[model samples]
Target: MSEAVEPSEWQPDWLSELVNRSTRSAILSTPFTSDQTEGHLPAPSEQQNDPISSGNSANASQPPLADSESTHIFDYREETRLPVTPSGERSVRRTLKGIHLFVRIEILYHNAPRSSNQMITVNATLGTGLYWRGGQILELGGPLAVLVSFLVVGLLSWAVMQCITEMLCIWPIPGALSVYVSQFVDEELGITVGITYWFTYSMSFSTLVATSAAEFNFWRGINDSRTIQGVVIYFLIPLILVLLNTMRIQIYGWLEVATGSLKIFFLIFIIIALIAINLGAGSKESLHYGAENWGSPTDFDRDAADNWVISLLMSISIATFAYVGVEVVSSSVLEAKSPNLSKGGGNPFKFSAIYIPVFATVAYCLSGVLGTLDIAWNHPHLPRLSWLPPDLNKDDKSPSRAAFVVIALASNIPGLDDTFNAFLVFTCLSCAATNLYVASRTLFGLTSRLEGGEGRRWYLRVLASFGKTDGRQVPLRAMIFSAVAFWWFVEVLSEMASVSVLHVWACECLAFIRFYRCIYQHREYLERENIALVQRWSVKNYSDYPYRSYGQPLLAYLALSGCIFVLLVANGAALWNGFHLLPFLASYLTVIVFIGIWILLKIFRSAPWSFVDLSQPKRVAEIFRHLHDIRLGGTDSTEDISEG
Candidate 1:
């Protein structure tokens, strides 16, 4: 055998060596090169300026030098290029390149940023609804009424969550509500639902801001004057919310985590405090009043005086408001670090679906029971009492008169009312921020579907521009537009927010019916072809999906029927008592707006009025195949050929 050459002496010819060096260097620096990888290279200055990078550089061990000609060639190229530049500039460039290379490598190997793992879902769900509206629910019906209405709506909410979570798991997309409505139902309905949903969230945001301002005024004991409250609501609150939303989504997620944790702790503390007060804790006389204030289960204390049925029906509308933000979980799924159900460590969508309604129901039921026990339903200081003097109920009927606040005042504890009011303020602000986020995202989703080609109308192009995201992926323009559009109507839209929520839920229920119908039709089509084919094509069975909800089509049916009943009867008592223009308008305005949008789209854009056709087997098969592709993580395209 020939003698083996030394390792260092085995260099190839110049051409071969050059090719080898270029290939090796390219492979080593591929992650930092924009042409090679999808990720962009960070500027050298950015690496040097990053505090985390600087800290890591101070402690991290240096990487071993490459034992190849490629490294020496790269060094030689850099040395020759630097001779023309100043020594200081050359030194800085070299240092920055080194830091950048280190950082990019570390990021690729160790600490990639993940947006999905953030804790926004639960926090966004527990917004201003429960805290601000509890007293109102208590006043509409007694403690028993509160329990019934919450359970009724809570079950309805659970069904809606199930339907939404199942869809989101298989096809997580931004503006999910509108897209589902459009694809399963009709494009006209989808546009209406999207704009209506955006409007609803905007109104909710304003309502929360006003409520937060009212809470602040209550805490400061400035209930007599509207001046400070106006400033807080119109200027301060809106400005802060806009600023917060325009920042990175990660920052907003962290903020929600902090506020959401506070809300949870406060809920636990207040529940315990309520139990203690009922058991004679915090009372000087040691009086134990347990469940005495619940009164008759069918009592109609306000608005529906003689008819308990109407009172109960109307209370469902108020309770529905409390459950509105729960669907924010679905709206937020697209932003999650792992939208795929199987890829994430656990299914956050399912957890949110199960946790939110259960938590809201339990919390609302307990607070209702314990609150009415502390303060009678017919208490004199109740804000909405019919017999109360107009002057007494005038402007003083702010959050200071909330049932929990009234209970705290009667608890005889020092500073308890102030503390509770502070929590109320926190809840309102947190929710306002959430509402803004949801509204902006909805607008972004809506605008994204609009065509902005050269042939499109000017207004359409302008609208589509809102869909474009910044480098950080935040929809900055959409957020500003949403905030500016609704800020002026903060005080006026408070009453409309609850009714709008009903409209949104009704639309979602209708959308779920169509979604179920699509699946059923697809199954029927597959069964007719061949029984064996149904098993072969696993899309027919819900269990074969990545995430399957319990009690599917039947649950969807019940939810739709329940939603319809509530919509028809919601605020019916107000009209029956007498035709008050404001209540009637607030109750039916969203419906009118929904119809008007459909009509406008039809007239202008010639949009189709009917639901998507499900009769064609070939089309249905394609849709199912697309879903299968999604299940397999084989594609990232949000739209399919069937959408056209």
Candidate 2:
């Protein structure tokens, strides 16, 4: 059904070295399968010179594409037609319904591996510090705090997801938040929001690289053997990942699956082990001190405002950081052979199944241990209590190593501590590699004119010059750029994950409100033109979206309000704990930076609010027309799909 390919051309010198970094996305992609996609490929002038002239036969004036095999770099296409049923079934455009492996890799890879790593350091990473204000700001202390924080973060993340899914479905394109905002809202938003997202992911990856080095320190001798070994690992890990990512998407998906599954199984085992230990199952004494750990705080410490709520609020915000990468579902909207996920309630398969299970399981297990420990009446006499991880005070702050510490102290199993630390190292490496990979793609998408909008034209050109591959698949240059930047990790950036996440969540909500209006306007355009419609949006709100987002303006508003609420209150703990200038500034650093970037773009680009382009054929009616034609078993001769 596809055209025969031309012979391969010589590769560019720069891309030649990273040739292996490209993907099967080149092999599987069918660019501009319909006119809607091709229509946006060029404006008036470029249209005359466009090389991939879909239906044009004799374009003698145009030059050939540089390489016959070169894939288009900013290919933001989404194949939305679901595999339809046979004549026996009546429901139209039935979704794939269950988990698809490739889709899992796209969304889960960003959050799951890294979040799993978060579980290992639950006692130390600033996220759970919310629960233990009296002991250590960033360390998990007694068991009760862990359980409460886990559930709190999970619920907050779910709310953000509710807001994003619909917008992602509406414009299931690669540039993601930035691109959507540009189309629905304004170009300045598209540019700034996109860069903020890219910046957050990049910063997160760098912090992971730094964290990876710290994980190695746990194994190296205390006699300074750690310095050299940590340095070696810091440089080596990113190089290995850059090389690994050179392979195809299938390989990428498989790698995530293998790593994520192992990580999940490892965490699940840890939970069961803790529960067994709590019940005295493996102990010589077989102690069963049931639910005593879930009692009460021994002492009350009031905040600056003399209230405990400030401590709880700060903890919730910090806990929110643990769930940072969950929005990758929206950021990396994979090609689904189902009604667009947003319109159809939500992703029934991967979103609910794979993402939730691993994250929830980790939270539950970590919380179970923490909650029981915190509330359990003083059991200092019990030998098992000796195994609990030590408090991470500010002066003695090191790699939290909480999970490894717990295994070392609690269990008599000979190699468990070594084994657990080894696995933690592997998770850190895997998560860092995947984070870089995701960041590379986001960078690549930003440079392109995503769906014919005013993309980061000059900036994308500059970045792509150094970041793109010859095959135009993987952004190997971007990966290498990211790898080098890993060494430049800053402490403030590490502390800004929750703020960064909230920033993007707020943008997605705003974008959705504008998108709703654009869709309504597109319908009116069609009506005024007297165009024959496929999906009847015959009313004020059309129920024709193959995958309709669950709650639109209302739920979107709720999510936005929640994000704003958290952002405002998230900094109280830091302010109350030290009452210093730098910490206070750093607490709202992400918000300030986000706004600062947006303001700069507004001044430079000066994108007019009234100039929002709603004519890009992204409407549901336009999207579903060709799919409907194909589903009815019609060919080019049977139905004309070309735009009038």
Candidate 3:
């Protein structure tokens, strides 16, 4: 049981606002049980602090909280704790899980919703984009690439985290990030960000499929399986993942903890192994085969460039997926316990502060050293087809004919080959499992939105009844539905790997560009608009990062600026380079169409047209005349000034 509160002599202007937001968020987060209802009311100390308390105490009156007065808030201290169960009662723990709702919210709200969600086990499964074909690159990039990517991703992730943390730390809502991002950003930015998030989720599922396929391919070669056998084995991995996900959340958490431990173990072990092998070889060496490998006119050189770049990109793509789940913490900010005292929400700064450079460094040391060792011995040759440590390329019967280039040159040592093989196997399995969990959860979040509001409503209603309301809530229906979606989506992506990497690269690049533009253009409103939402929810001192450390907001300004230039070139190259240009054109056009659809949706949803429109409500009416086609039927065509 918790201690009884005493009235504080000092009061801040934010106190009433904080209490009101906390109470409201508790009410909205989930259904509460009779015992859990205390969270929805004022603390006993707060009740004593009330001006009316003096009169009541003088009259020797019983507390008004015991009466059925039904004011804006009440006290529920006596109702919070349930009696402890007997030692033999196993079922009691299961029942007690539901009671944790109020307690979790209190901790989250006070601590700032971001930390709780970010530190928990599910975060490892949620934020990493482990679900796509190109999801492994960051996980395997060398130090130079990892360093660059980390700077970019770390800052971006941090910015997003700060925005979310500020908005929901005080109030702590389940859909917290979306709530703030939607409110603070102009409609253009809001809708675009929403669409980007949706696509990221979708692609994450695709990454999972691609990763599983790669791992299965590795395994098939190791075991000397035929193509059909490999396919069967590949298909079965996701099934096990789905079954695991379908169980209760605690079970899922335990599985993640176990799997995560294995992953970290393998990653650490590989790094140590690579360092040992390198040290034994008695020479520090460069990992790159040099700029010469980039490309040349000779057929062999051109082919080498293509293979190396493509393989490197593939690795980077996969690594990017690993980082995707990092943002999953933002979704459950509302259920954090005591958000005001804790007061951190979706601040990716905190989460990614740990995520970006740290993971990137780990990836570089592990994969880079391994690659260096492979290349040192193999001398720029790809891995063997036999799936053995002496071989960089596994003999798997996948459509990917390009071999895994072993960058590690230290393979000359005795017993090293066997150890490397063991390490590779563990890597494949760990990455596969991580991807599956991410894919499952992303699908669930996506499906929850597609189901309209009913799915979320029911999830909240259940919590409400338990008096266990909090922002970090989970909707079981969403998870189940997501698992089903992942099952189908993975299959489709795995079968579609034959398409040229250039085409796929272009599509991904364009999508990234559009997302960057949306957020960049409305950076100010994106931060400012979350205040009301933060206030309403009693999220403490919600505020976004004021400035990005990396130059300007626009992504087009970076050294990677050439990549966007390449996207344009790739568009033309694909059309002219041989295969039918029509398919390429169609796919490229579809990407544009998707962006356009989101823009139109924002218009129809009564979202403000620009950042300027966020301040001038009257201006909204003037612009609506020209933008009447954008209006939708649900919410009013104008901003709800009263609500703000």
The lowest-lDDT stretch of 10 consecutive residues in candidate 3 is 83-92
* Candidate 3 structure, TM-score to reference: 0.52
Per-residue C-alpha lDDT of model 1 across residues 562-621, encoded as one tens digit per residue: 777776676555567656666666667666777887788665554455677667665544
Span of 10 residues, lowest total lDDT, candidate 2: 633-642
Q: Give candidate 3 misplaced runs (Cα > 4 Å).
A: 1-116, 119-172, 175-177, 186-199, 206-210, 219-235, 281-301, 304-322, 332-338, 342-349, 354-357, 376-476, 486-590, 599-612, 616-644
C-alpha-based local distance difference test score of model 2: 0.45
Rank order (by TM-score, best first): 1, 2, 3
All candidates' lDDT scores? 0.56, 0.45, 0.32
lDDT of 2 by residue, 1-644 (tens): 33533212221111111111122112111222222231132233343231122222232222221112113333222222211111111111111112223223322322321112112112112121211221222232233444555566666556556556554433444456666666556656666777777777677777766766765666657226755665566666766777876654435545555665665566556556556655554443323333443344321123222344554555555556556556654333321222221133223322432344245435544644542442222222111111124433224333444443443444565666666566666656666665665666566556432222235345434554542343424556666666566466667666674467677777777777765655566766545433222123555424323334455567677777777877777554546555655445556877788878777755554434453554664343333332232232111110011121
lDDT score, candidate 3, position 166? 31
C-alpha positional error of residue 92 in candidate 1 after TM-score superposition, expressed in Å: 34
Measured with C-alpha atoms, the lDDT of residue 54 in candidate 2 is 22
lDDT: the better of candidates 1 and 3:
1
Candidates arranged by lDDT, highest first: 1, 2, 3
In the order shown, the candidates' Cα RMSDs to the true structure are 15.5, 11.3, 13.8
Overall local distance difference test of candidate 3: 0.32
